[model samples]
Target: MNQSLNRIAAMTARYYYILRSSWLRLLEIVYWPAMQMMVWGFLYTYLYQSRSAMADTAGLLLGAVLLWDVLFRGQLGFTFTFLEEIWSRNLANLMMSPLKPAELAASLMLMSLIRLLIGTIPVTLLTLLLFGFNIYALGPGLLVFFLNLVLTGWAIGLVVAGLVIRQGLGAESLAYSIMIVLLPLCCVYYPVEALPLWLHPVAWSLTPTYVFEGMRAMLIHGVFRTDLMIACLALNAVYLGIGFTTFVLLLQSARHKGGLLTMGE
Candidate 1:
């Protein structure tokens, strides 16, 4: 027990140090959020100008986008940090350390939380303050919603990392492809009802759909519907489990294929 506790402490402290590195500059933290905010802000203004009645609807959509940015950015932080280490060949040092793979993974996930806090949290807070949306109105439901978002994002990161492990940089094209597919389906700037019925199941299966819905529920209605919150929590757990399992399998495959040690020579 003592050994496990000490290891976690060390990993967490290392994560803190890594987060403070120049690579994680304030600009890097804010860049994605700013881009998302600008694009969505323009769209909202345009929609409001076209139809003044859509202002509240636009607010709901904009809030979802803001929250999604934080979740996506947090997961990306973990995956990219690990990938950069691998590209620079520094991962070899980590692999040879007394630390375990799970510990290293934990550290990366912890870094995700830190990045999310530094990057995503600010944007979320700003959206609430500017749009007069109260995320905390649902209190515990808000917490559950955020947790679901984090887990789902982590799962996506794991799957992306697995592909990177198998195909190296060549697999990176999938990132854009994923974004293209997800943006319309994730209910980022619109409600799921706006999507055709045939696509609703597909969208809801993506986890982010439920997350956005739950967020909208909490923010717009200020009431936690037991069913929605429970569903979101379940989806998060399922995806998080899949992500961790896939990450482990890919890590093993990489080890067997010598991918773990094959850095830029």
Candidate 2:
């Protein structure tokens, strides 16, 4: 019994030594969970405005939930597909294949679309049947909004996959844990104005913020918010470029460093 106890203690100490040497890992120890804590714990503080100002808009909250799920599911779909390859220890085999990164990315994206449809279609219908709310009633703007959110998800997922390839499995959990940080920043359940005055700028910097704000505008005013749509597109372009660049560079780095060969070890 004492021998087993010593082994457990030694193993714990070994990782603590690793954590001591790695600042990013240490930061992640706090930043990862703290971001989620901040996301959910304080996300509701912004909802006071919805209750007070959007009280009469029947579909505002419901619409936000549906759109939020679109973004969430889209990201998971993209990231998990990539993570699964890593888990299965197939990344080296993938890299050795003739497939290009962009092609791989496209395949992941198509998978994301399929996953999003699989997860969302039934829920949307259930919302219609149970709550008498057809998410489709939001109309053509909803399609644009959905597209932008998915683009943002793809961009984030690509960056995440890149980081894992470059940094190894230390970041493996990020695929699941990272996106919720946007729950607060994207103002999913509330308007941007609901955020603290300082957070307004931070929230606006993200494309999904525009999508959610546009969603609110559509629900409340019956306007499509073409201006927000334009802004969302512009930001999505920047994020997608960054994500693509990051992935390609990190992939090259991993390959050069033999990270791919030893990945998942």
Candidate 3:
């Protein structure tokens, strides 16, 4: 166990070194946030200015934007960083070591989590600073919501990483494509009330919506909304189970086919 911890520490330091490269740091601190702000900021403006105004427009949009971006950051960091090892032809060198695949996966996931937090902290503070957003009213429930979202993000990351291992870059694109469909259906910028009644149940089943609602309920209204919190927790578990299972299956298959070692070559 001590040996495994050392390996993870080394890998994490390597990733941090890569992250500190001036170009990547600039992209993370400036380019990505600006692009996201432009797109989601526009939507936020529309939501507030129009008569068909969104429910808790500022909070809903901000929460949605933050949550979705964190999810993207975590999943992409895990997938692309692992893929980078392959692109650089260094994966085999690492594979030759005593490190197990599960340990490698865990270490890569830790890097993703770190990246997500770095990106998220800045954007979250910016949202509050620039948009007058406030979640403090949510009190301790805020922590619960944050944990739920993070777990959901990690679950998504595993599936994304697994698919990239199995199908290469095309699978990477497909993994992201799922987000395009999910963001709308998740009711990030809008509420389930805005969706067709037929879609309400489906939207509620999605974990993000529950987190969003729970945030609004706790912070905006000072209500517990235990049902929403419970729902988010349950859905998070389901996603975690599905994602981890799929990841293990695909990873084992990839190992058998040498897909893990040969991808990006």
List TM-score per model, in order: 0.84, 0.78, 0.83
User: How big is the positional error of residue 190 in model 3, measured in Å on the Cα after superposition?
Assistant: 2.5
Global Cα RMSD, each model: 2.9, 13.1, 3.0
Worst ten in a row by lDDT for model 1: 127-136
Estimate, for each residue in 1-265, the C-alpha lDDT of model 1 and write its tens digit: 6675677677678656665676757667877786677677777667756757776677676767766775677567767756766566676677677766666667778777877778866666665565444445557766776777777767777777777776676765554355456778888766799999999999888877877777777667876667876787788778878877887787778788886676534
lDDT (Cα, 0-100) at 216 in candidate 3: 58
Weakest lDDT window of 10 consecutive positions for candidate 2? 33-42
lDDT against the true structure, per candidate, is: 0.71, 0.77, 0.72
RMSD of 1: 2.9
How far does residue 174 in candidate 1 sit from its true spot (Å)?
A: 4.6
lDDT of 2 by residue, 138-163 (tens): 88888999999999999999999999
* lDDT of the structure predicted as candidate 2: 0.77
Task: Name the top lDDT candidate.
Answer: 2
**Candidate 2: which stretches are off by over 4 Å?**
1-58
User: Model 1: runs farther than 4 Å from truth?
Assistant: 38-51, 128-138, 172-180
- Angstrom error of the Cα, residue 201, model 3: value is 4.1
Q: Where does candidate 1 clash, by residue pair?
A: none
